[model samples]
Target chain A: MKPRIAFFDFACCEGCQLQVANLGEALLDVLKLVDVVEFREVMSEKWAGPLDIAVVEGSITTKEAVERIEKIRARSRILIAYGSCATIGGVNGMKNRSPLEEIRRTVYGEHAHTFPTIATRPVDQVVKVDYYVHGCPIWPPEFIEVLQAALQGVPCFPPDHAVCVECKLNENVCLYDKGVTCLGPVTRAGCNSWCTNNGNICYGCRGLVSNPNTKGAMDVLARYRIPLELVLNKMSMYNACREQGKTP
Target chain B: MRYVTIPADKMADYITALARRQKVVAPVEKGKGQFAFEPISEGREATLTYIPTILPPKKFFMPQYETLLEYDLHEGQKMQAVVELEEMVLFGVHTCDLAGIACLNTVFSDRPKDLNYLIRKNKIVIIGLECVAYCDEYASCALMNNHLPNGGYDLFLTPLGDRYIGHVNTYIGDSLVEEGGFFRDATGADFAALEEVRRRKREVFHDEVPIDLDEIPRIFAHSLRTTIWKEIGDRCLSCGNCTNVCPTCYCFDIVDKPNLDLKSGRRIRVWDSCQNERFAKIAGGESFRKERSSRKRHRFFRKFRYPVDRFGKFFCTGCGRCSRTCMARINLKETLAQLAREYV
Candidate 1:
């Protein structure tokens, strides 16, 4: 029997789901391998229970998000975090760097009291993540590879190296040498060094590598005369939850 | 003939002639003090006086990505072994890069030989260029003894004041200059000029590091438990830049890319690096080289120690790309000097 796959979104921009939709011609191939029982973005019918695979996107930003994700985990045989938000809390976690009350007041203005907020946490913090497809909007190639691996009943490990590996393979001149401060040295790869290849600096949107040498990255920044606070602020853009080391 | 000469003015014509027959790859400036090996149709496009290109000539041989096989699942897993080959003349290659190519040849040609690399390597011709002066501060070619050519190329060129003296090492090199009609027999005066350049080169180039070359393996062997690994590791970003830019470091990973049909795909070999955290990991969830320090130590050992035991040769060509490309500013020569101080 073909494996049943479902994609769920919580509190994200939904760009990751769009990446799957934007698969273009390859989406036909993906359909041949599995049955898409539930995809709210594309179809109306939702599967009730007993899902073969559940791919989740976005962070748990509210109490309701936590409860929904846990319920989804209970019915799925394998749960894969499908983006930076689901795996590392993503840019949504930047609210965690500042006080929740201040963030709520700034965004909601006078209606701050009417809305309740919670510290952003990755899906893995609330429920076990069987696999991870990591990036800002999720690199489509990795998503397909992870799905294929899940169907084959094998583990698909992402490249645990830094983005500089892919950047060098592309033979792009080092951005640091171009007077640009980049987080490519410590940020996890699997995006094919996309930002750096396009001449933009790495903001560490993929989060730090498994064994990031942060001190070494800091020294590199210092050599380029880039300030520590500047890098810290950039890191918080997608990594405030991981950096804080808070237990849910 | 053992020696020939090409006047400085006629180099462009010779280059254009060679490009007419096949691809000619040479160094070209990429601005901001960087250069890369690119195909050129004119001699002026080749930067003959440039430093080592950002990536060595390895890209033409092994390439970053090469398809090994194509598979179709419609026939119950039918696969065809494939090799992508290119025929070309690699021009203006520095001696350090030549040594690097030689190191790769030894590795790929070893037991359980890689037919993919060997098959592709045979199609290209290598033309070497001598470096009479140091390229920059990062180079340790003199220390590694790779500054001088050691039988890795078909032809070698040494720049003189008004001309280049060429040493033809193979019949292919002989016929190239002969058929092109751009070179002439070297005269006695030309030989004297070449001798003068070599004589002065001895004075200009010396070991950049203080330690002797023979002591390197010994020092590395004893320093396995030393603090240098931690010191270097503390500054290493594990970015894999050092390995990717390294001319002699050749590790790779194999992956399959399926087409939109899901039944057809190509298996490709892509370059991998030891500096990656999972490079040493096994399927049992135990990674022997889990620490950043251990991975960094493994890189150094691969170049200085393990290759020596396995191949009886040092894999380091002293091209200095590792130090130059390192974001952490970890200098290879300085690290060697520290090792010499502690373990020599």
Candidate 2:
């Protein structure tokens, strides 16, 4: 029987969902292996029945999101948290850095106190996630690999090393040499050093590795004479939740 | 052994002749003091005098990504082993890089031979260029005893003022010299110029690190539990950049990439690094080198101790790529000198 797969989002840019949609001809090939029962972005069809696999694509930032993600966990056999938002709370987690009231006033202005929000938490923090497709907007190749593994009942391994590995393999000149402070030395791999390839330093959108050498990363900053506040500010963008002891 | 000389003016013609015979990969400046081994159709594109390319010529022998086998599910697990290769001439390889290739050759050519690497290595010809002076402060080639040509190339070129003294090491080099017709018989004057160049180089290059090459293994043996690893590990980002750019580091991981149909896939080998957390991870979720310091120590031992014990030679060719490419500025010479001070 084809696995009944569904994609859901809570607090995200929906760019990861667009990546799946932008799979071009590969999406049709993937359809033959699994039955995508509910993909709100690409289809109008929605299934409330039990799903074999549920691919969630955002951080849980609201009280309703916490409840909905638990329901997803209860219904699906395998749950995948994709993108930086779904897996690591992403930029949404940056909200937790400042006072909630002040942030609301800044964004909603007069509409403050009307919108109820909670600290951003990853899908894994709410419920168990069986697999992960990590990146800001997921790399399409990794998405396919993760999907294949999910379908075959096998485990897919994401690179636990730093982004510099892939960056070096791509033969791109080290960003540090170009006077750019990159978070690649501590950032998790699997994005294939996407940012560095395009002549941009890594902002660590995929989040830091499982066991990052943060001290070493700081040493790199010091070696290049880059300011600590600059890198720390960049780190807070997608990793504030992880830093604040929200998720493991 | 045959000797030939190519005048400075005909250097371009010599390279053009080589390119005309086959695909030629030579150093081309990438601006901002960076150079890369790129294919050039014209002789003028080859930058003979430059520091080491970002990646060594190991890219040609054992490519970063190499497909090992193509399997098809249609015929009940039909598989065909294959090796991707090209016939070409590699030019402007420095002595340090040539030593790096020699180390790789020793590894892949060892018992339980990697037929794929062996097959591809034979297809390419090597032309080495002597480094008259030190590339930079990062290089420790003198310490590694790789500053002089150790004969990993078919033809070795030594620049002496207006002409290049070429040492033809093999039949291939002799045939090239004869076929290209750009080289003339090496006169006694040219020989004196070559000797003078070598003499001058001897004075220029010296052990950058304070330790002797012979004492490296002894120091490494005793310094296994030294605090230097911890100190370096504290600064090492576990980025795997050090090993990736290393010429002698040949570790790789094999993976199967199934096509969209999920019917068949091609199994390929891609470069892997020991510094990676998962590099030492086992099936039951146990990582041998769990601590960053241990992984850091392992890399040092691989270069200094383990390879010397196994291969009877230091795996480190001292190209200084590991130091040069390190994001954390973990200087190889500094590390080695510290070890020597502690244990020697």
Q: i-RMS values of the candidates, in order?
A: 1.7, 1.3
Query: Is model 2 an incorrect, acceptable, medium or high docking prediction?
Result: medium
The alpha-carbon lDDT assigned to residue B96 of candidate 2 equals: 92
Which residue pairs in candidate 2 collide? none
Candidate 1 off by > 4 Å = A37-50, A244-248, B41-43, B178-180, B258-264
DockQ of each: 0.63, 0.72
lDDT string for model 1 (A148-247, tens) is 7887677787777889899888888888888977888878898998888888899888878777777777778888899999989888888888965532
Q: Per-residue alpha-carbon lDDT of model 1 for B233-257, expressed as tens digits?
A: 8988888888889999899999887
Candidates' C-alpha lDDT: 0.88, 0.88
Please give the RMSD of candidate 1 to the true structure.
2.5
**How would you encode candidate 2's per-residue C-alpha lDDT over A43-76 as one tens digit per residue?**
9999999999999999998998898998989999
Candidate 2 to native Cα RMSD, angstroms: 1.8
